[model samples]
Target: MEKNELKTTDSDNGHSPSETEKHLEHGVPVDAVNLPDPDEGLSEEERKRIDRALLWKLDLRLIPWLSLLYLMSFLDRTNIGNAKIDGLQEDLNMSNNQYNATLTIFFISYSVFEPLTQVLLKRFRPSVFLPVIMILWGICMTCMGLVHNFSGLMAARWFLGLTEAGLFPGVNYYLSCWYRRSEFGVRAAIFFSAAALAGSFGGLLAAAIVNMDGVGGKPGWAWIFILEGLATVVVATLSFWMARSCSTEKMDLQLTICQVHDFPDEAKFLSEDDRRRVIRRLKLDQQSSAEHEEFKLDYLWASLKDWKTYTGMMIYMGVDGALYAFSLFLPTIVQQMGYKSIHAQLLSVPPYAVAAVVTIFIGFVADRTRMRGYCNMVMSLFGIVGFAMLLGSGSPHVQYAGTFLGAMGIYPCIPNTISWTANNVEGVYKRGISLGFVIGWGNLNGIVSSNIYRAEDKPRYKPGHAVVLAYEAIFLLGGSVLQHVLLRRENAKRRNGERNNWVEGKTEAEIEKLGDKRPDFLYTL
Candidate 1:
């Protein structure tokens, strides 16, 4: 049993709550910092060694599988871009604008199902849930290969969107449960980097598949869909076996004590003396468990009611609108530069790759500095500059450079913003719902993104580029203002002797009984 948990409970006599409330009402300060460090008994070297081992466990257990799942999802959704250039349009005998309409259709389904999917992820274990979605989407993608016309294409895309709706937000909420807040950005980038890799891989794969044009009387574009879809199905099967949720849920799971030790060091900062005081305040024994097996189911509703929920949604929607637009259309944009299909696909690689690298670096820096809001603001500024340059420039080389900067600036900070929100909010239901709504709402921009590029704007795509640039600028301004406001509020609270507001709901006494949660649950700014 962990000492912190005991301090959080009502005193054995149950009268401690009233006494504590009275003291707080009188403005008598509680000595919150006088507690002893839980890890004070251990040497610094031992602590570092423990931290490293725990980090290794997290990487092995969670990061790779989560990243791979995200990679495939991104790949499956956008591979249509590759198929288009390989002759999907010609074979379907579709008009110039129909392909764009198909893209929009997917978002319609995607937006409708996203919030529901995120909420349901918790009901079933990841092993059962994620694999089911993967297999379904994979089969749909494969089925796309067999479609003879536009209707078939539209149907496949819609189902694909439906199955994929929950994946991003669900995984995000899942990751929050596993890693502490400080670790979120890097892990998220690691997961999202798969999108970059997928961009490169999708191009190479499309380039190779295009060579088989007219094989078996089917266009190479058809073969690409068939083969890629089959790959999705197979990969999804693997995910079923690999993906896991909580430690207690996996029957095959085997984690060593070294792995368990990676929990946040904030726990180590509490001592028996502090624990005793906490017990007196809220009142409980010193021995209790640090990591509990479950959390409240009602957290979901509580999370939805928070203003932070909508704020986070707006943040991601505005920033990610630009990110998704670029991701989905970059290959098409490159092809418009008059390069050969292969050249265009290959050219699309650098920008996404560069974005991935910056995202990873941003994660590490955010964790070390504990400054997510500032990092996000900086990333947005870069996006504005990059997009502005592209809108005005005509040179292929110069335009490509601008696109690269736009990609880099916007993507790196996005995961941090998401992780920031998840870390601040407690309770599994709230966390789950909050993550879902944030991601689901943000994804609605796909509706906007899909329509950004039109036949009327083709070749130069001046209108599409301009629209995204404006979107980026709006997001930048909004996020900057919101963060500033949040910071000022946080500062005011601290100055007014309201440190207890950092965690919200729980008074200092409740926190003592609940255990020093080590969430560092400060405001998002």
Candidate 2:
């Protein structure tokens, strides 16, 4: 009788128990047309299903590799700063001002190409496109070892920027495809900490390579370029085999690509019978790629119309200008502290090490506490004071201490700012375009940093210090204003119960179906 009853139940629902199990595991709506409200109280099976789905999303393999890619990308870009102490300028016959100009030139190319790459990612698979660019840049970095003149150094610098142009923007876009908006900030921090780690690692690596200065009749700077470049190439080649394309990307996918392959079979919490009923109710067609159908230029139009885009651009530019200034010139700054060249390179390690730990810790904490704006404001204030202490004091110990505090405190907030944009933007294309534009355009400050520290101000580059201080002050004030504007808009929206034009077409009844959705999508506060 029991066997007969089981058979009857199986026949009633089209999905087998295994298929239902799969659906629940993947967070596929068991009843596809309308997902049940989590607050309505779930059946034991349904609760188990949600738990499994969350667990699957937290897979460990994805995090480490993505973090490594970011690490190498950042390390390769800034290792040039470490190279300066080991005869880089002398070998290239670059004047002090010419050296800075080369740094400026990299940003010109970087800024111009980033937005173009975002458009291109829509057509090309990231697994292939990103790694190819990585390999190419790695090759360019290696060539820096061979450069013997100002023009050679200039050419290498431009190509370095051109090849690396899409890395951060592309990676940001790529991560968004995998993780939902709520999860992006912490992940973004993990990836961005690679920049901080690179600072420390580059210092250590340079210290070791400087020991090779007289061994191969090559200057220590040449070894720095050669070894780091080769490392980049090797890592890029490996990443080609390891990195995953987006879940929907078809044809030429990597073996290691992370994706939920069988939504129906994976959901275990919903009964097989219930799951089948749900599948029958959903709007999705198994054969269709939602990404292709949903792709639109609407986001580009909306973002352009929004004043926030320009405001975001200014904020990014100020933050990056401050960062790149320190990254490219810290060794020079330390040289003024009376350390030998190699010793200066080694000393760069401690500040960045502290910065890395502080950045990662604070990023996750702020994200957990949901305090993105406050965290950023605090970082800007710290930077302002750090710069002030160095500018006003003559004590080498105090200045060094100020530099470390500034580096540690200020660095964590920039990525949060980028992640803030990622979380708030709704459309993929707009996210891509905005990210590319902000990152690329912000690099313009590299030019300013390059020129600010002229040879004339060797011991104290008073102008350079003053320039950054001014930029930070403006950022502090502007950031406060922008936060206030966003808060006011959010409050007004809540009070008036008005949806913007973006959400205007959708009925409130329809939008309310997404229970956890933040309709206002307020900027991080």
Candidate 3:
């Protein structure tokens, strides 16, 4: 098809000629619908003003609620560590291995179900799906308080993972739907830093909750589960009113190319101008070849075949393994530093707090510089140094300082890594599957992490520190370098018009089915 003819037909799929003329009056060219350059007619000042307003609206409506939901998710997931120091193991007559097994069981279910849940999230809207799962997981977390034995705790944990499986990947996919690739890092960081803050808050909250040891014939550990779980249930219920799904139908109409499912438009929060500006920018940001596809299993299979998907998964696995182990076992690690259990919980706060601030800072810097791979490598170095300090020193003060370094290093990398993969992949279905697969496989690290820090390796837990440090050096650091090199080489190849053998003479539809492997699709390094 001729370029102009294709553009007109695509535009007619969603927008009328009158709408096209209206956009043209505001400086958008009707024939330039999917042009690589956009905002050509707006003044610099006007563009800045519009962007500021749009960002403010998005931040106000989206970030706080998503952060809160993630905070609750992280709390419910890791509060078991807090409950452990409060005597959960003793009450249930569990050994250290059995307790670790409970943590492992959660990840097993979590890893297995995450991809399926992402599919479900697409079938049901996020507004309906996210809250329903939150309520169910809330019930499961609350039930953990009532469990009297190892089998009961295991059952509660298994179900908790099943219910909570969709949240992280679902949220990532949702953010991708709204933001440009270049603009995604800071927003993702803001959302993910909640997990770090949750660590800090979980510690402080556990310290306070553990004091209710004798209230109403319930132990401190039981109270921790009961109170936090109830809070999640209440918040989930409230989310039914607060959560708004970005209308895919509106997005479809604006893009003129992508065909989206007919969703009820809930864009009342946005003014007409702001909404148009947002949509125009998003259309410009998308690759023209990837613009019109609907959700399909072919997209999923294409993503699975992309080698970058597995490499990204490796990076996520290494970093997430260290993160999960640290969050799940930090209190115990602190207690081993010669402090009482209560004191240990309080001491856990400073590192996480510092990490939270550093995480935000890194996010901003990463977005501004557009250097995710370099940022990831530098952050991984912080973790490597921190672990080295912990293993090298015997002093509590030095060990504590190491925690700060470790927290800053690992926490920032989580968002960067997520955005890194999200930024590179195209197509909604392909992006969804790639994210779900990366996160789901990455979480298997939780299983590996849970087993690494045994009671046998108490006090220093040198083996645990050593294992995490090696992963930081090899996978996190080395993987980023390799990814950067590979992407650069691929871009160079495309610039030279060197198509892969399989791509020759393929129909446009078949080539589009190639997703990220299209010669024009450049990887973000």
Candidate 4:
């Protein structure tokens, strides 16, 4: 309701917020952690070296475990592709409609639950909430193994969708809480690599697990669910400890209080020095005083009202339509390429494996160059070319090669887009909502892709390939070109002081609340 109609109470100062926020970290007590500051008795060179080491340590503790969680989440969600080829349809006596319904229903719930899960993730502890829901989903997957009828299968899938919805968006917000924007693309890529790896590993594992078809009188499809689902439960149990402070965190961008819930003194893994350095770095990197902000409905509304959120949604849709369709049907597609079911499962592994490596490589490139948009666009071209090969070529070998190119191009764009969106935002609640909707709405395309790859379009499913290719083209233009150009122009306007009047005469607190809109906050390309 003020002049700009966008001010919050935190933006009352006339000076840069960081200048005043140097020591005011997100509510972590200095004395509570019981260790000396890493800044003490150190030169700048020494301090930088120590900070680098600390980051590596944090990487070791965080990325691998989180990657595992994502791997399981992706595997459980998409492994049905493997199950379908392995006799789930014949064993369950399902018609084409029934099977597609299962896939469609899962995505409907998956998409619908994502935004709500994001809000809940913000309000609760990550360690408790993420793991608990993971356990529930694991149970759903395990129940999927036990389903003897159509209604039972439907019920299990619906619950699985609900419970598993929290993990992806929740983890994105969680990673954003710790890493700076410059470092975020790489971390998100690494986390996403797990999903790529899941596709590869899922195929390889399915080839072997299917050999157990008659073991305990259970079909291969049921065991795939039972075993993979059980593995998630086991991992969920370990997550309570493996995730450490990550699970208990509130996306606060500071891990000051450690991992032991309300007890700051109990987190044994991170010494006081590490916690101090981490919190200090966050204060420097962040634009807002998150310590002063709380969850408010207004923040959610602010995120929804932003044009960037919808832009991100459409951009993410560009690749996800291909990603979900391709991943969900790769095994079947391979089977249709004149291979046996077992060989199809085996062949599906390499494309995903290549995709995982390319995804990580592109992520680091985006980080080092800070060129998120260009990286996304360039990589997307690979998929565009690949999908064309699949649609135009009649040769099985050429179509098969297209799968690798497609995976390579499509997988990396996901993390790049997500990190770009995150980099462009400031403030906790707004950031969380943006991530949730961007990802959730993007997932709606999964339904589109899944349905298009219908039973009627076997062998060279020309329609499906064409649809994916179209989306890839959109990804290059809308997701990459438009976003890059817009942000680049916005940054130029700020640099030229054209938007300076928005911040003029505003107190520092009011200025702080302007977030990415503030003249000083440069948008990442």
Question: Which candidate's TM-score is highest?
Answer: 4
Instruction: State TM-scores per candidate.
Output: 0.80, 0.80, 0.87, 0.88
lDDT string for model 1 (402-447, tens) is 8888887778766877877775565555666777777777787887
Better by lDDT, candidate 4 or 2: 4
The deviation in Å at residue 480 for candidate 2 is 4.8
* Candidate 4 similarity to native, TM-score: 0.88
Tens-place lDDT per residue, model 2, 1-525, is 000011111455663333213222243333343444332456879766864564353334345566776777777778888887777877777888788878888988988999889777655666578778888998999998888888988899899999999888887766654454445677778878888888888888899988898667888888888888898888777766544433232323333433212233222333454344333322121111113323467656666765556767777777788888888888888878788987898888888888888788777876686666666777887788888877888778877887886686458877777876665554557767778777777777778877787779878777888888877778643664585477557645632334333334555443423211223333445
Model 3: per-residue Cα lDDT over 1-525, one tens digit each: 001111222454664433222323233333236443345688999788868877776766667778888999999999999999889999899999999999999999999999888778766877789889999999999999988899999999999999999999988877776777777888889999999999999999999999999898889999999999999999887666444444433644222111111111234455555555566665455422223345677877888898889989988987998899889999999999999989999999889998888888888888887789999999999999999988889899899999998998799999999988988887667788889899998898899888889899888999999988887888888888888888778767754446444456666456545555655455777
Error of model 3, residue 462, in angstroms: 1.1
Residue 90 lDDT (model 2): 76
Model 3 steric clash pairs: none
lDDT (CA) per prediction: 0.68, 0.67, 0.79, 0.79
Candidate 3 residue 500 Cα shift, in angstroms, is 9.2
Per-candidate RMSD vs. true structure? 7.9, 10.3, 7.9, 6.6
Cα miss at 208, model 3 (Å)? 0.6
Off by over 4 Å in 2: 1-59, 243-297, 500-522
Clashes per prediction? 21, 12, 0, 15
- Distance from true position, residue 145, model 2, in Å? 0.8
